[model samples]
Target: MEVRVLPGEHFYGFLRFYGKGITFPKGHVESGETYEQTALREVSEETGYKNLEIVKSLGVVTRPAIETDGTEVIKDIYLFLMKITGDDKGKAEEETEWLTIDDALTRLMPQEVEFLKKIQLEIYED
Candidate 1:
């Protein structure tokens, strides 16, 4: 499942980042970029918000990815506390929706709500 942690005034919004079937803002350490750099770039490109920052490492998430069945993979997604830059008015990119962090968590099947709680408390990672 794809996930993005977004900043809000009183709390945060965890969103499902994607375009059609593709989750555009996936975190992959790019060449000549640190993990943080990768996070910033990916978030900016996908969300049009360039002020993303890695507040902490949320740990490595591994799963039997649907795109690659039976092949569990490990991904290093550096979770950050980020603020959106600029007005999102009239932003044309599709395949995204503004969902409450709670709702966003529920969007993903399985133990999604439980996982969201971990991030809410910063419990699973420091």
Candidate 2:
């Protein structure tokens, strides 16, 4: 997942998943692709913002997940702190929103909120 911050305002970029609520952009790692590569691709595909610079990694979060077919699995979510380098935009596959930390805390999922909280200070300090 990407914690994408827009410069100046420091608004965080989030994706709204229908029925699932708001969260960061993320996707599976394709074969022969590095985790960073997958993160960049997924962010672009989901938010349509291509001009991004990865500030640093926020580490990985491992959690149990349930698939649509009721399959249980462990998911490792790699978190990256990315910043928008330009105003370039494209077609987004999902709905995207930019929000202040307060607004994002209110709208984001519980787990996502927790993750944001853990890195809140780090994000601002960067």
Pick by lDDT: which candidate is best? 2
Q: TM-score of every model?
A: 0.58, 0.84
lDDT of 2 at 42: 96
TM-score of candidate 1 on Cα atoms, chains taken together: 0.58
Q: What is the C-alpha lDDT of each candidate?
A: 0.48, 0.80
Residues 1-126, candidate 2: write the lDDT tens digits: 234444555777788866646777788999999989999999989999889888899877666777889999988889898887888989999888877777888877677788888888888777
Off by over 4 Å in 2: 1-8
lDDT of 1 by residue, 1-126 (tens): 122355432334343444312222455677799776776666666556544545565554333344346665544344555545444433323344555455556555344444456676563232
Q: What TM-score should be assigned to candidate 2?
A: 0.84
